[model samples]
Target: MLDANLSTQLKGYLEKLTQPIELAASLDDGAKSAELESLLQEIASLSGKIAYVRKDDDARKPSFAINRVGSDIGVRFAGIPMGHEFTSLVLALLQVGGHPSKASQDVIEQVRTLRGTGSDGVLRFETYFSLSCQNCPDVVQALNLMSVLNPSIQHVAIDGGLFQQEVEARQVMAVPTVFLNGELFESGRMSLEQIVAKLDTGAADREADKIRHKDSFDVLVVGGGPAGAAAAVYAARKGIRTGVAAERFGGQVLDTMSIENFISVPHTEGPKMAAALEQHVREYDVDIMNLQRAQKLIPAREPGGLIEVQLANGASLKSRTVVVSTGARWRQMNVPGEEQYRNKGVAYCPHCDGPLFKGKRVAVIGGGNSGVEAAIDLAGIVNHVTLIEFDSQLRADDVLQRKLRSLDNVTVITSGQTTEVLGDGHKVNGLVYRDRLGGDSHRIELEGVFVQIGLLPNTEWLKGTLALSPRGEIEIDAYGRTSLPGVFAAGDATTVPYKQIVIAMGEGSKAALSAFDHLIRTSAPVEAAVAA
Candidate 1:
């Protein structure tokens, strides 16, 4: 049904796509020089053609009302679309090109209009990073994907050690600070969701209220979780103008459906813990926005000054210091039923809600350290525990896996794929699966499912605003100062090795102390000004 020439061209494109591009040992490598050059040119041409096809498809795509746009996307673009946030740009361009994606055409068109033509000028982006940071990989990958998506955008990633001079000159405070056209756009862990939201919405204008935008604060906390809550309460009780915001509050603690690890309380739910934290923060007239994500941060112009916190809502808050207590979240499955049962019994933290299913049979779907850990924890209370794994062998740390295997109550289902989650009501009850090697179909009855897959740092909102680790967590000094001054962060957002509520809380307290110290060293004289 296709034209012979077009069909042949399509086949060639497919072949090229299937072939992996040979990367350089160094960017200046010359081993396969000639072949690589030709391949690059061919890739460029193919990309252009693909873009053309996408544009053509966009002409026929369905349109939707504008309000469906997410706030995260709008904030990301206005502040800085760097790091993981850059992935939003790549996806945005793909949407404009009519590539198959979940984003609506209208959103794509808006991005296209904003990006305009980078062809006329060179867009230089430099990110400061290091191998020691676990959160840095996602940032580099996202930015590299953006370059592939848009040829006009030139990107350069520099190791932090190699750029010591430049870092010092720029007050290099972070691992993944991004500069756009030589201007600081963002400098920390920003997510793709926030990036798209920011870009989709036009750049925000500065506020008219000088006090709200420039006045010093009694306490400025960076993160929004348990530790942040504790710090905010302490600071506000001492009569401080307290304000807290993160890409999302409750932190990684929210991903935990239940929490049995915290001392004193035998059990607690994440949402409940978060609600209590929110209530505690609110009790002292503290300014708090749960879903309102931060975009950019800047030190006040006045000496001994305030720090400015910018929000996705286009508003700015002035505080004397900050406390970064944002936490982490569960890693995604990237398989079926993951998104379908997000809040429907498919959970991550057993400490938060393990008691709900006192005798209910459930599946602990993973084989990693977290998986085995969750199985061990759940086996003591749950009716039955099925540890489902897709790998040929379990990869959990030896000791944890040994403990898990020793438990007679835990059953390991290996080399299996959960094709779907079988459920008729609001909650999950069972799963349909396939055995990879045997090529067999099977079903397992379950009352609940806990996915202890992994975790994602909640630093996507800070892309181009601070330094981030390969794991996407914020990079902080021993005292928790981020790449940017007057902007300290802590908890899971930082490059901490282990992610625990107690650790996050401790880091939050440290960040608060540091923020306070910075404030004391820099606070300016207060004037009797009108409340703006």
Candidate 2:
């Protein structure tokens, strides 16, 4: 049941309901069922437009469905939709009750016209998730909204922790593992646009057509992380046409667990911060192209000609100046059995996948801040945590190192390099590591292996086009000027000294200014020649 303060807030939210909704619960005589029934009853009391009913017909107990009074379109929940899923529950209620979604009209139309995969022409999706996962809510809410929009589409969000047997049998070692038509659909975090693109095969062509017709921009940003956002904002403030082509808005920041050193803001979550960045960018005149991966950069032929940036979707965007803030991604161990067992006990995100290994032994591979932090976090949930470092000593801050040493269920191993992930064909059961000084191989039985190695810059596409450092980072000058004419680079993708969110933002802003300066100085002669 919800607390009084929560009830009051929920009541206020429920007041937005324009139509009557019903909760059809399938439960049994168990503690979780009783708790769910109480929660449902309490929710029903919040608004007269809501009703709760019990039915023990579903194969999964302690489950419920949200539906409008007279519609077949609905969403289902196979466990208590609390914790991270609480927002998903609220969104389902509002969406089912006729409240409009915040998604773009084009995306909404795409979802509404989707035909489920299969000969049956119906779609049934099941997503396994965990309460502690920060990435699961987006998948659950997106699917629930899709079900509400299309009558033939039905989605049920299942809690992996509550359904332990199913999680083990299916080898669902990660949160947000989605299945469609009883077959594996996708695993890991996904957005509404991404889900629709997967479900509708022909969507790519239509999207590509739309992107191809976009007008040239004055300043185009090729990423949507902290750096790209800052560049877009700075360019837009100058009253010039700006567009951001990003693989995913927020980039690696979306996978971050906690951020406390952002200056001014003492504490914030990654997703929340990402949302704020997107919202702030939206307030400007900048045009955002999400899920767009830059494939190649072709500089303009002339001094003031438009530069072309090719995309992975066979489309391209032209601009007078470009800011490359493509950012970086988590580096993998790349050892044998790592890729084979990914999402089957080998994961890169401890925050997203840690809860699945509750009470199990796990290994954290790395020696830096991220590895130490992941080990400390996993120690609280898992039965045991073994922190393995390639270096002789941990590189984390003194405070963090001190805190890690104080944990009772944690073990630290220095001068260790992860050799291989050991797993059966189904899932991981152990890991192999070697000592640097002793030159001895050791194998430890564990259920999960969380890789917290460093990051790899997203600069492969620009390899032959511009100057790059030995480590594959884009080479830039102090003013953020890249080797290419009229092109600038920023953030983790560039040769900036430190890699931090705040630093990325400042670098992005500087890059945008440099691009603008380049634009004005270069375009004057071209305009003068044309006038003559």
Number of the top-ranking candidate, with TM-score as the measure: 2
Candidate 1: residue 37 lDDT (0-100): 35
lDDT of every model, 2 decimals:
0.58, 0.92
lDDT of candidate model 2 versus the reference: 0.92
Tens digits of per-residue lDDT for model 2, 8-56? 9999999999989999999988999999999999999999999999877
TM-score of each: 0.47, 0.96
Question: Which structure among the candidates has the greatest lDDT?
Answer: 2
Q: Where does candidate 2 clash, by residue pair?
A: none
Over 4 Å off in model 1, which ranges?
1-218, 233-240, 246-285, 288-291, 295-307, 341-362, 368-370, 373-385, 389-410, 414-449, 523-532
Error of 1 at 490 (Å): 0.9
RMSD of 1: 20.8
Model 2 TM-score? 0.96
